[model samples]
Target: MPDRAPQPVDRQLPTDEARDLISLVRDIAQREIAPKAAEEEDAGRFPREVFTLLSESGLLGLPYDSEYGGGDQPYEVYLQVLEELAAARLTVGLGVSVHSLACHALANYGTKEQQAEHLPDMLGGGLLGAYCLSEPASGSDAASLRTKAVRGDGGSWALTGTKAWITHGGIADFCTVLARTGGEGARGITAFLVPGDAEGLSAAAPEKKMGMKGSPTAQVHFDGVRISDDRRIGEEGQGFAIALSALDSGRLGIAACAVGVAQAALDEAVAYATGREQFGRPIADFQGLRFMLADMATRIEAGRALYLTAARLRDAQRPFARQAAMAKLFCTDTAMQVTIDAVQVLGGYGYTADFPVERYMREAKVLQIVEGTNQIQRMVIARHLAGPESR
Candidate 1:
C-alpha cells in the first residue's frame, strides 16, 4: 500500500510564520524528497540537482541572517524543517546541516568584508559546501588534527594535509577547512575557506559504508593547496574554537535528523503492524507489538522536544552547549533503537532492503558516530556538569 501520508507532525510552533514555513517544508519534502529517496539511495547517487532545488527554494540557509540570503528562521523553526527533510531522506537533511556548518565560520567570525564577499552565495547561491575538520588521525580528538597551513610568499598560505570522513567531500563547491597554523595543540588551529577547484585540492574515493551511500564520505587531500591570506577566517589560532562553536550548533542538527529518522521508522512500523495479518487479526492487536510502537513514538517525541529546547536556548543567546550535547546523545541513541525495533516489527521483510527500515537502521548507526561519537558526547556532558577533567 502507499506509505501512510508522510506521518503528521503536530509541531508546537511559536508563530504563524514559523508554522507556515514548516508547512512549506513538509509539502516540498513529501513531494520532492520522499518519493525518490529509496531509489537514489540504492543507486548511491548524490542528488546534486535536488540540492540546487533546495538552494533555489531558500531552504538551505534557514537559521542565518536574511540579509545574507538566508530564510531568517529561528533555530527551532529551522530544525523542524531539517526533521521534515530527514524523514524524507537523511542525505538531504544532513547535507543541509553540513553545508550550514561549513558556512558557520564565515557567517559568525569572518570580517565584514569577508561576509559581504561570500555569505550570500554560500547561503542561497546553490553552491554546495563541506566542513573539513576531522583528520585521518584525529576523529574524536578533533583538537589533535595535524593538517598544516604554512605561510607562503606574497601573503599566501599553503595547506597540505588530509581530511577524513568529510561529507560532500568530492562534490562541494567550497570547504571550510581547519588546519594547524601555529604551535602544537588546539591553540594553533586556524580556519580557512578553501575553494573546491584549488590547484592541489582533491578528494579520494568515497568510503564504502553500510548506509547513506548517496552522501559521499571521502578523504579530501590538500597538497599545498593555495589560499590567499584574505581567505583566513577569524584569528590565526582560532579555528579549533570556531570549529567547536559550529559543532555545538551542528550537534542540534544531528539531533533533529535523528528524531526525523526515528519518527519515520515508527510511522512505517505502525503502518505495517496495522495492515499485516497475524492469524485472525492484524498484528497491531498484539499487546507486545503495541507497546513497542508506544515506546518508539514516545522516544521520538522526547527527542524532538529535547532538540527544540536546546534550539530555543540558542535563539535566546544562552549557553546551550551542554544541552546540545545531551540532545545529540539521546536522539541518536533513540534513532538506533527505534529503527532496529522497526525492523523487528516487520519481521523478515524489515531485515531485507525490500522495506526502508533496514536502511534506516544502518543510517542510524552513523549518526551515533558523526558530529561526535556518543562516548565523546558523554565526556562533554560530564565536563559541563563537573568542570573539565583535571589535567
Candidate 2:
C-alpha cells in the first residue's frame, strides 16, 4: 500500500510539453497526494487542500480554454495528467473528472455572458463542482429525470426536485442541473447552472459506499430554488443533448481513470511476483506467472489506446459518442479483470488489506457502474450501429 515511484516505460513517448506536465504531476502525486491516500480513504475524508494544490498548479483546467483562466492543454496531455493522479489516488482523480463534467456545460453551451460570470470562478476556485442529472427514479434514464424548473417572475426559473447519487454533492460550490421545463420526455428538459448555496438547495448526508471512500456522494435537493433565465444553458429542450454531450467527455475521463487503476494493480502484481519466492525461485520467473503479467500489460495498453483515440476524436470536434462508450466499456472491464488477476497472483495476501490489490478490486467495480453503466454503453453502441431508424 506504500506509494510506488513512477516506473519509466520505453513505450510512453511524450512531447516536451507532455513530459514537463507528467513530471510535475508525478512529483506531486508521490510527494504529496500518495502519502495521504490511505489515511484519507480509511477516514472517508475529502481532500480539499489537494484540490487547491491542483487548481494552483493549473491542473484543474487542463483541458479548458485559456480565455477563461484555464490551461488550454490538449486532450492527450490532459488525460496523461489524469492517469498520474488516478494512479496515486482514485478518489482525487475522480473528483477532478466530476469537476470537469460539471464545467463542460458552461464551457460548451453557455453564452458569453454566462461563461463570463461563472467560468473563471468555476475553473480557478478552490471549491469543486458537481453534475446534477440523475434522480431517484432515474440513473441511466437521464432523459426521464423528474426535476422541474418552472419559469418564474422576472425571467428567473424555480427549480424543484432531487438529484440522486451526485458526486461532490455536499462539497461542491455549484452544480450543472437538468430539469423538466416543458412536457414529459427529453424535449421537456433544460440545463441550468445552479449555485450550491442558492435558497432551497441542499444535499442529504453523504452515502456510505463500497469504494472510493474519500469521494463524497450525496443526494441534492432543489426546493423551489430560483435561478435567472440567463443561467439556463442553451435553449429549452436542450438539456438532454447537453447532458449526453457532457457524458461523452466524462466517459473518457472514467476510461482514463480505469486505465490508471489497472496500471497500479498490474505494477503491484509485477513487483510482488518478482520479490515473492515460490518453491525455490521467484514467482515472476515462472512461465505461468509471466504470461499473466503479459496479459495484464497488454490489456492496460489496449485500454490506454482506446481512451486516447476517443479523446483525440472529441478534441477534433468529431462525432465520438460511440467511441467514448467503447473506451469506457473496454477500459472498465479490463480494470476489473486486471485487478482480479493481480489478487490471484498474490494468493492469500491479495484478498487482505495487507496488499493494495483488494482495495483496487473494490474500487474498479464502481467504474463499471458510474458514468453510465457498461450495459448502457452497449446500448449506445448498438443504437449507433443500427442507425437513426433503430430507435
Candidate 3:
C-alpha cells in the first residue's frame, strides 16, 4: 500500500492570520519537505534549497520583528508553524529552530546599527545560521565553556576555541558565538556575531548519527578569528545571561518539535494498524490495539497542550522558563514512547528500513538529549520549585 499522508492537526490558532499561516506551512511541508525527506535523509543530503524556499516564504523569521524582515507573529503562532514543519520532517524543523536561536542575541541585544546592517539578510536573505555555545569540554555545564576572545589593537577581538555538536556547523552563513573574555565562570563570557567564512574558522567532519543524518552536526573551530568590536552583542560579561534566555525560548521550540514527531508516529501507527490484518480482521479492530491507539493520541494531545501553554506564557511576557523545561521534558519523553509504540504497531515491517517507524524511533532518541537533556530539564524544574541545590 502507498504511504498515507498524515491527518491534519486541529490547531487552536488565535487569529485568522495564524490559521492561514499554519495552512501555508502544512501545504509547503507536504509538498516540498515530506515527499523527499526519507530519500534525502537516506542519502545524507542536506536540503539547502528547501530552506531557501522557506526564507522566501517568510517562514524563517516568524517570531521576530517585522521591521527587520520578520513575520511579527507571536510565539504561540510561531511554535504551531514549527510543529507542522516538524511533523513533516524533523531536520527542517530543528534546523529552523537552531537558525532562530542563532539570531536571538543580535535581534534582542545588538545595537540598532547592527540590526539595520545584519538582521534583514539573516532573517530573509536565504542565509543559514548556527548557534555556538556548547564547547568540546562543556555540554550541560554551558557556563563552563572555555572558548576565549581577547581584545586586540584597533578595536578588534581574536577568538580561539571549538564548539561541539553544532547544527549546520560547516554550512552556516553566520554564527552567534560565546567566548570567555574575563575571569573564570559564566560572568566572564561574551557573545559575538561571527561570519562563517571568517579567516581562521573551520568545521570538523560531521558526526555519523543514528538519525537526522541529513542535518550536519559537527565541531566548529575558531583559530584566532578576528572581528571588529562592533560585532559584540550586549554588554561585556553578558553572554551567559543571553545564552540562558535564548535557551529558555529554544527549549519551547524543541518541545514543539517533539510533539510533532510524536504526532507523526501516532499517525503512522494508526494508519498501519487499520490496514494490517490479524485473525482475519484489521489489527486496529482488536481491543488491545484500540487502547494503544487511544493512549498514543492522548499523549500527543497532552504534549501539544503543554508546549502551547508554554508558548502562550512566552507571548504574554511572563516567566516561562520552568514551564518550558517541563514541556521539553514531557514532550520529548512522549515522542520517545510514541515512536517505540509505533514500531510495535508495525511489528516486523517496522523493524526493517522498508517502513518509516524504525527511523522515527531512532530520531526520537536524540530529542531526549538535545537542547537540554531530560535530566537537565528535571534539574531545572527542581531548582525552580525547591531552589538551587546546596553547593
Model 2 earns a TM-score of: 0.97
lDDT of 3: 0.92
- In candidate 2, residue 93 scores what lDDT? 86
Off by more than 4 A, model 2? 6-14, 388-391
Model 2 Cα lDDT, one tens digit per residue, 101-155: 9999999999998888889888886657999999999999888889999997798
lDDT scores in order: 0.93, 0.89, 0.92
**In model 3, where do residues sit more than 4 Å from their true spots?**
1-4
TM-score of each: 0.98, 0.97, 0.99
TM-score computed on alpha carbons, candidate 1: 0.98
Query: What are the per-residue Cα lDDT tens digits for candidate 3 across 1-391?
Result: 2233546998788999998998889889888888888888888999999999999999999999999999999999988888888888889999999999999999999999999999999999999999999987899999999999999999899999999999999999999999999999999999999999999999999999999999999999999999999999999999999999999999999999888888888998988898998899999999988998899899989999999999999999999999999999999999999999999999999888877888778988999998989999999999999999999
Shift of residue 245 alpha carbon in model 2, Å? 0.7
Cα displacement (angstroms), candidate 1, residue 345, comes to 0.5
Model 1 stretches with alpha carbons more than 4 Å out = 1-5
RMSD of 2: 1.4
